[model samples]
Target: MLYKFFVKYLKPYKKIVFIAPIFMLTEVIVDLFQPFLIQQIIDKGLGAGNINYVIRIGFFMCILSLIGILAGLSTIYLSSKISQNFGGYLREDTFKKIMSLSFKNLDHQSPSNLIIRLTNDVTQVQNLILMSFRILVRAPLLLVGSFFMAFFTAKSLSPIIVILVIVITVVLYIIVHKSTPFFTNSQKALDRLNTVLNENFTGIRAVKAFVREDYEINKFDKKNENLYSSSTKASLATALIMPFLMLCVNFGIVASLYFGGQFVIGGTLAVGQIVAFINYLLQILVSLLISGMLLMNVSRAIVSVKRIIEIHDMQPDITYKTETVDNIKGDVTFDHVYFKYSDNDEYILKDINFDAKAGETVGIIGLTGSGKSTLADLIPRLYDTTKGKVLIDNKDVKEYSEKSLRSQISIVLQKAILFAGKLNTNIRYGNQSASDIEVEEAAETAQAKEFIDKFPEKYEKFISQKGSNLSGGQRQRVSIARGLVGEPKILILDDSTSALDAKSEALVKEALANEHKDTTTFIIAQKISSIKTADKILVIDAGKLISIGTHEELLKSSELYKEIYESQLGKEA
Candidate 1:
């Protein structure tokens, strides 16, 4: 199975692989010729006292050595080229599969697990392919070739060679079988450590604010200790292979010398033939030892390959429908939609219905865990609704191509993620074709221009990873600007203004009113003031739409709205 996988990827670089074996063949022939030459130097040159003949053979040996060196260099160069292209192709394929995954599929996988599959796991498979070309092919060919040469040259000593090969193969099988589980577990333990460290680094501010640094450190220490222990065990197991193989090799040599010496004394074998027979025995044992090492690597590679393949084979739950939508308007309606996370038994969003026409603004307000975000995610098909239809411009979202439907809507999530890039690059992420002037205009509208202009590089200033250098409000404003850059027909701002102060929030609101008058916007927020001026407010409670109307209408009729308003505004009435 592993060999077939390499052949498939390497098929494209067939010319390289084709050239590689010819090099190996030359190297092997040179290797085989060396032992015979040693016998010739002993029997014909040194024993007979012929200087010119010895000189000629010695010169030919030099030529053979040069040929071997050139062949080895060419083999390594070609193998490296194949390995690099093969590794790149596999990593690219895995990444594309990850990009195609839906939120449902992503939720089921850990970030650390995914990272391992991408980096460590892919590297393991890559190393195997590279080594297979350099060492795997060479070792097996050398072993079999040496065994056949040993028998052809001297049949009497062949039984000893066969016995030693059998013993070494059996010993290697036992060691690898016992060590396989340790190698597999080591990969899992490393993933655990990665997960803990990733979470800690991401939440360092929270940990420090809560004065839980020691606690977090201890938690990390525990995970680190587990990784350390697993690695020690795996290393110890792998360490056993070399020493055991070396011992077996020594025993094979002693056995060959003891038995072959008798043939020499009886005149049944020439002194040179006995030496040649001993050299063959050593060659056979060396090949077996090399085969053992390759098997160990192949075992680990199998586990790593399976890890990578797991992600490759995953079928996304929310794949694109075959149908396509050429034109999609701003009309959106949720009809009796119900949803729950795959791991959860209870629905996060129960049966719900609502609509927002073109050029209308809808405000969703509720207490925490009211399923507000889940409701908003339905329109974009981020997660499939369990029980109902979410329509876009009167057609079910599933009926349209996912790309076409998503392209028309822009969502500024509550988290407000930003990548490491220039300020303009981040803003223009929603539409890469957006000009610098367009990006600056969106930034001004989001109330981000004043702060952005203070930077020395202005629009070209680098935003650190996830915008860590920027304040929370600044990050939120930049995220809002990105969404606005798309000029989306439908925009969903999920508490996007929560990080800004009241004054900046008002300025952003005014900008939205002036710039996006024709667009349908859904504003989700906790502060009553944020949605007080909205055209329609939907009061949601536990995944259900409790009431929908203007702000004043809801304040008069909805008790939930009244409670939320009084809590935030501190007004009893």
Candidate 2:
């Protein structure tokens, strides 16, 4: 599965991948030639008292070293370029896939986990690719070449090389096998740490307000400790590989030198040949150590690849049609709608049925978790109903393309979210081509113009992330202005005005009535006063619609509506 992902993402950079390994091989070949030249200098040039010959061979050896340096530099540049570009493309595609998922799909995963996957996990895979193209390709080739050269130099030394190789291989295999699971656990711990940190920062205001700083600190400490523990265990396992490799290589060198001295004394082995043989043995030792380090990286990359592929394999629950509609009349209907978050969960909305005509105001009132926001979400098709259907313009919403359908409906969520940009930029987010006059008009209708003009830069005033610089009411007003700038036909406000003062809410309502009388509106509010003046009122309780009438009619007919009105208004029925 991991191989398939690499193959798919790396298809575009095949040329770089192919060329980088060739350069690595060239460097390895130059390194292999060095000891042979040194042997010739010692046995033939120096032994025969030929000083000029020694100089000639030494000069050629310097040229080979320079060529090896050039090849190594070229390989490093190409491998880094391929890894970074591949990681960039993968990150972009993964983010796009996350954005395309439905609300239900997004709810299954936390934002922090997704962020970690895009950043830390992608970085792991990129580093692995770089090492594979550079050290990983060269290590095995050097190992094989060194063994052949050592045996050809002296047949008696072949047994020592084979014994050391077998012992070191066994030790490396054990270290990597034991460390693989720890690496996987460490990655998971890192995800948990990110989740805790994200939640702490996002709700820092609440933590300070409630005087729970110590509690939050303790929570973060616990998560941080877990991450540290897991990472240390994995690191310690990898650390053992290097020391064991050095021990085996040094022992092999000692054993060869002692045995080669005995052979030289017996007049059978040349001193120059033993010197060349020891160099070849050291090369093999270095290559094995590099291969061991690459193995550790490979294990971590495997875990990261699996996590990334899990996201890529998910199929979005909602699919769109290609059909386009020239105009939408802003009429919406819910026919026997039933919904639940998942199949195993109990239904949150049951048998809901309602219709609102163009230019009509429909107010929805419900207790917390009574499906007010869920009903508003259906109009935009944020989540499909488990049963029944939603219709717009007398056609099933599923018939229209997602872009065509959502473009006509504007929704202001309960949470007023704003990005870091100028006030004008956020407002223009609703309609990118909105003119300056239209921007002012929308802000006026939403009651945001007064405070906006108070700032020195007016519409160009910069807003911080999540509008931290603004008050609750100011942020709500800006969000409303953003929604109105598009001039959408169907506007759904989900308790968006709760932060506004009574006077401000009244002005916003009046502007909507006067300036956008043709647009259909759905107002979901907890306060009875906010929605009492709508053309029709729908009362919901425990996922069931108990009454549908005007304020006066509902007061006379429904006990729940009468009780709520009396509680808020303190009036007798």
Candidate 3:
């Protein structure tokens, strides 16, 4: 897994990776000489009563230590520089993949999971790269060098070093194997916690209104606690391996002292040779312990790399790479369009056919769940039709690039969404280069200028998050003004005026009619009065177009339309 991830992301930094190993090897060489210098001082100077030999070896040892420190610093700097750059590239690529993913692909992953992959998982891989250079490369070098140095002095101490290495390796492998699955589970728990917390914060007003604060709080705490427990369990299991390996190291050193002491007292081993063997044995033991620690860090990093790979391997369902079209006409047609969200379920839109010319106002009225909004959504390709063609300007909508198709259409939803910015900035969102006069004109046409002018700063006043500080009708008007600023050829109002009073609704409607006389408008509304004056009205019922005519024609012929008209107008048809 580590090799695959490196091939994908780290291949570009081949120079840095290649140079880092040279510095690491030099550092290891410097470290291997320290113990040999100590032996020389002990045997030649202390044993023979020669202070000159001790001083020379001691001074040379200090010089080697300084070179080792410099090499270690160079190794760390190069390794970290490569890791940081690689992490940045990984993060950007992951986020770009998420952005290109369609709704179908995105449904399988949560926002928190994506965030974890981008942040926590990326950090894990970065640390691994740094550690592989700093410690992993040194462990094997020290182990092999120490063994060779010890063999030249006395081969009897070699058995103890070999056994200690085997024991530490087995223990480290067991800990890594057992803890990997638990760490994966801990990451998933964190995703669930993020989802619950996001939902609660977004619906905080509704929760408080219904007096369910305690319920929401309890639910969030449960998920949060689950995450904490999983993390603790994973951490405890991984932490136990280090101390256990340290114990093995300590035992090997003690065993070497008892066995090597006999060889020193006998005529077989000299004092210098015994001293050198002890130093080599300690070096080998220390290297084994360091290898165990490096293994643990690398094991955890492998889990994160696999998690990030899941996202990178995903293919977006919607792929459109055609050239952008700048010239667009607003003629739209739906030919026998049938659509369903699932293969097993009934169609959301069935055998629908309609045409809206370049300049017309088409009103769509329907009962709840009648697929009114779904029909309008087809024009912008929000969801693909199960079986039909939606055409614009005599060309299939799918043939156009996504940018060009969306640029020609604008929609204002029932629930207004406003970002935290000045009122002018919100109104000018559809067209950023719109001047102050054009912004004020659009707001006035939407009947938003009245409430907006009441504020001291007027257009410069700041809106809160999602426009929570504004009333429902006020937010609706601002959203309308935003859509209108673009001057789109195809404008869709999906229940855009439900919150307005009779007077303000009529005023906004009149403004739209006069200002945008040539733009094609598709209005999805619940109120009969909102659609009565349109050039034509479409009555949809249960995913089918039940009736299509003007309001008066529908009142005279269609019973369902007449019924809705009477219910709202409060009179007999």
Candidate 4:
């Protein structure tokens, strides 16, 4: 699975991946030739007392060293380019997949988990690719080349090289195997820490209000401790590989010197030959040590690959057909709709049935946890019903392309989310092609123009992240203007006016009725006064539709309606 994913994203950079290894091999070959050249300069030039031969061979060695340096540099350059590009592609595609997911799909995963996968996990895989093209390919080839050359140079001492190689390989394998699970655990710990941090940062105001600083600190400490322990375990395991490898290499070096000294005294090997053999032994050991370190990265990358692939494997719960539909007239119907977050969970909305004509205003009022927002979410197919169907303009919403269905509907969430950009850009999010006049008119209708005009830069004024620079009512009004700018046929406001004063709310409502009379609107509110003037009001209780009627009719007929009206209106009622 990991290989297939790499092949898909890295296909465009195949030439670089291929070319990088060729340069690495060139560098390795050049390194291997150095010991042999030194052997010739020592035996043929120094021992034979030939000054010209030593100088000639020494000059050639310098040229080869330069060539090796060039090859190494080229290898590093190409490997980094390929790896960075592959990481960029992988991160972008994973984020796009997350954006395409349905609300139900997002419910199963946390945003922090996705953020870690896209950034940290992608980086792990990228480092592996970079190492593969550099040390990973070079180390094994150098080890093998040194072994063969050691045998060819002095067959008698080759057995020592063979034994130490086998021992180091076995020990490194065990260390890597024992550490793989710890690395996986470490990554999970990091995810948990990120989740906790994200929540704390987003809700810092609430934490301060509730005086829960110590509680939050304790929570973060727990996650931090888990991450610290897991990382220490993985790091300590990997740290052992180098010291053990060096111990074995040092023993091999001592043994080679002892044996090679005997062979040199016996006249079977010359002084130069012994020197060359020890050099080859060191080369083999060094390559193995480098390879052992790279294996740790490879193990971590394998875990990261699995994490990333898990997201790509998910099939979104909501999918649209290829068929396109014309602009809908905002006529929405929910037929026997039932919704549960998951199969094992209890239903949030049960057997819900309702209809709204084009240009009609429907008010939904219910207590918290009564699935008011869930029913509003159904019209845009944010989540598909567990049973029955949602229809827009007399056709099943699932039959229309997602673009076609979403283009006609605009929803202003209870929490008005705004990005960091100019006021114009935030408002233009609803309709990028809207004219300046259209933008002004929408803001005016949303009752936001007055406050916006107070700013020095007016429409071009910059907004902070989540609109932190604006007051709560100002943010909500701007969000409403954004929804209105698109001129969507259906506009759903889920408690969007709760922050506004009665006068502002009334003015906003009056503007909507006068300017957007052809557009259907669903206003979900907790206050009776907010929706009392609606053409039709639907009352929900614990996920069931308790009553559907005009405000006067519901007040007269429904007990729940009268109780809520009296709670808020009292003697005025």
Predicted structure with the largest TM-score when compared to the true one: 4
Error of 4 at 381 (Å): 0.6
lDDT digits (tens) for residues 1-573 of candidate 2: 777899988899899888998899999999999888888888899888899999999999999999999999999999999888889999999999998899998889999999999999999998998898888999999999999999998778789999999999998899999999999999999999999899989999899999999999999899899999999999999999889988988898898999998998998888888999999999999999999999999999889989989889989989999867647888989999999999899999999998999989999997788998998899989999899989998888888898788888899977999999999999988889999999999999999999999999999999999999999999999999999998989999999999998889989999999998989999999888888889999999999888999999999998988888878785322
* lDDT (Cα atoms) of all candidates against the true structure: 0.85, 0.91, 0.85, 0.92
Question: Model 1 segments beyond 4 Å from truth?
Answer: 1-7, 322-325, 571-573
Candidate 4: C-alpha RMSD to true structure equals: 1.1
Model 2 clashing residue pairs (backbone): none
Cα displacement (Å) at residue 391, model 1: 0.6
Query: Alpha carbon lDDT of residue 434, candidate 2?
Result: 94
Candidate 2 local distance difference test against the native: 0.91
For candidate 1, the lDDT comes to 0.85
Model 3 misplaced regions, further than 4 Å? 1-4, 150-153, 267-287, 454-458, 570-573
The TM-score of candidate 3 is: 0.92
TM-scores of all predicted structures: 0.96, 0.98, 0.92, 0.98
As for lDDT, the candidate ahead, 1 or 2, is 2
Q: Write candidate 3's Cα lDDT for 1-573 as tens digits.
A: 557778778789898888898998999888878877777788788989999999998899989999999999999999999889888998898899888887667877877778878998889888988888888888899889988888877787778777877777787778778877778778789888988887888888899999999998899899989999988888888779767866876786677777877877775766777777777877887787777667766767888888888888888766665878755668878899998876888998899888888878899999999999988888877777789999888888888888887777888999999999999999998788889999998999899999999999999999999999999999999999999887888899999999998899999999999998877899999988888898888899999988888988998988999889878876222
Error of 1 at 478 (Å): 0.6
Tens-digit lDDT track of model 4 for 432-456: 9999999999999999999999999
lDDT, candidate 3, at 223: 95
After superposition, which runs of candidate 2 have C-alpha atoms over 4 Å from their true positions?
323-326, 570-573
Show the colliding residue pairs in model 4: none
